[model samples]
Target: MNLALKDIRHGLFRFVLTCFGLGLLMTVVLAMIGIYNGLVADALAIVKAPAADVWVVEAGTQGPFAEASSIPPDTRDAVARMPGVAAAGAITYQTLEASHAGRTLRVYAIGYELGRPGGPEQIAEGRGIATSHFELVADRKTGLLVGDTLRLGRDRYSVVGLVEDATNTGGDPAVYVTLADALSIQTKLDPAAARVQAARGAEPVKRPTVAAVIARMEPGADVGLLVATVRQWKHLGALTEAEQEELLLVSVVDKARRQIGLFLGILLTVSAVVIALIIYTMTMEKLKQIATLKLIGAPDRTIIGLIVQQALILGGSGWAIGLALILTVKDNFPRRVELEPFNAIVLAGIVFAVCLASSGLGVRAAMKVDPATALGG
Candidate 1:
């Protein structure tokens, strides 16, 4: 007879209740892993959207995602004329809050020239922006739909298309418009600000500048050569796509990653402690039975097997429950929760190791129960 299974069946309700509680704890651990993955994904979304090989920005600054960067609008033309350059587009980025559908919507506005490399690669719904003046392609996360019009700055723009999962590092949904319209929206001051500027007799603001110029190189082109050529322009800095992604991971989300890792460590420690304590307590409650088995000449291995088996069942059941819960509710999270199969597999391995380690305490307690204890009590 399996002593562990028999004991668990004797207290099935309690065993299930304990597993439920541990399941909740495991849910939190899995969620943290997913949230960390989501943070990295969100931070790199915009940079990867354009699929450009080279990014040119104002000299002495990182690309637009990390810090402020503004280069001349004509930078695109200069880069396009360089050898090995297949295409180039000047793009601007800004974060703005606008009133929409009785709520304030925060969005990251992107300006790209028509017939350029910076536009959205595919439209999920409707059509791409065809007009230069007031059309937009918005991320579906912005709650925008085709034919919906929203006022931005001094003019109104109509949504012509929708894209999925397009967001900036700050998690704001992205909207795409023509370069001219973006410049117009960005430069036009509100009436109150305009009045203040008029009172000061400030000269009209110069034409709005672009955040960066992105270039796509021809197949088999020397990316290093193009980056070097852009860097020698005296007023421009260039980074390849890999360098830009590294900069973002190191600069933009490094602290968040560290924070999540710390939390995961803490949670795992707590889980080990809780499992050890639970097993120890269960062993203490069954000391007499263990003594009886010893008196009947049961071997030490049988007793050890009982403790280890119970711990594994508890941990394995809890982990399975937690995985199910997280998968069901992951999509409802405000920010993305990207859980991969590999992440789940790694967690399972960690939990298995913890279970084995935790059973040591119960094993120790069961071994100390003297065979005489069963004769006395």
Candidate 2:
């Protein structure tokens, strides 16, 4: 006769209700883990999109993503002429808000030269930008579609293509345009502003600048040598892809990672406390039955097994329910929720350890029940 199973069957309704509540709590814990993974992925999305071997930016600054960087638009030609350079492209980055279809859309605007290394790698729908000006390739998250024309600055641009998972570190969807169009959109003045400038007799704006120049090296080329060569130019700074990613993680999203980790720690501590309390309460409620078993000469191991078994069942059932709930609703989350297999496995292990540690309280209380208590009460 399994005393733990018999007891649970007797109070099946209460057991199910308790598991349901714990399942909700577990769902929150799993969601936090997924959210942290998503944050890291989102932070690195743009940096990884280009797949460049080296980044060239204004001297004395980190890459364009971390801080302001501007280089001459013609820097692409100079980098391309360097030995072992397979390709180079000038690119610019900016954030803009534009009104469209009765709503304001915020986007991260990217400018790249045609047939360059900085454009979207693949288009999920429609074709890539075919014209040098007034054409746009937008991320699907932006809610813009092919043939949809939106006015930006002094000119209008038509959405010619759509990409997936293209967003900046700030979670804004990305839009791509030719270098010429992006410069015009970014530097052009409104009619009123242009008139004021003319009245002041100010000279026309100088040629627009690019945020950075990205270069792809030939296969088996020495990346360190190229970086060093660019650094010696005095007006330019260079970083390999690995260094750029590290700078972004350390400078851009480091605080967010720390905050989420602290929150996860708090949640796990609370879960352990709640499980311990629940097991202790259940053990107290069955003290007389435990005493009866002791009077009938049941060994200490049997009583210990009963408490431990019940604790495991509660925790295991709750974790299973929570995993199901998270998987079903993860796609609906505003930001991505990336739940890898390793993350789930690690969480399961933590939960198992928590269950065992929590059962200690119940085991301690059950061991103290006097055999005489059964006869009296």
Question: Which candidate wins on TM-score?
Answer: 1
Q: Give model 2's TM-score versus the native structure.
A: 0.95
Q: All models: lDDT?
A: 0.92, 0.90
Please tell me which predicted candidate would have the highest lDDT against the true structure.
1
Q: Residue by residue across 220-328, what tens digits does model 2's lDDT show? A: 9999999999999999999999999999999988887899899999998998898899989999999999999999999999999999999999999888888999999
lDDT of each residue in 144-254, candidate 1, tens digit only: 989999887788899999998888866789999999988988787777777888889984554589999999999999999999988888789999999999999999889
Model 1 lDDT, full chain set: 0.92
Model 2 residue runs over 4 Å out of place are 204-207
Worst 10 residues of 2 by lDDT: 198-207
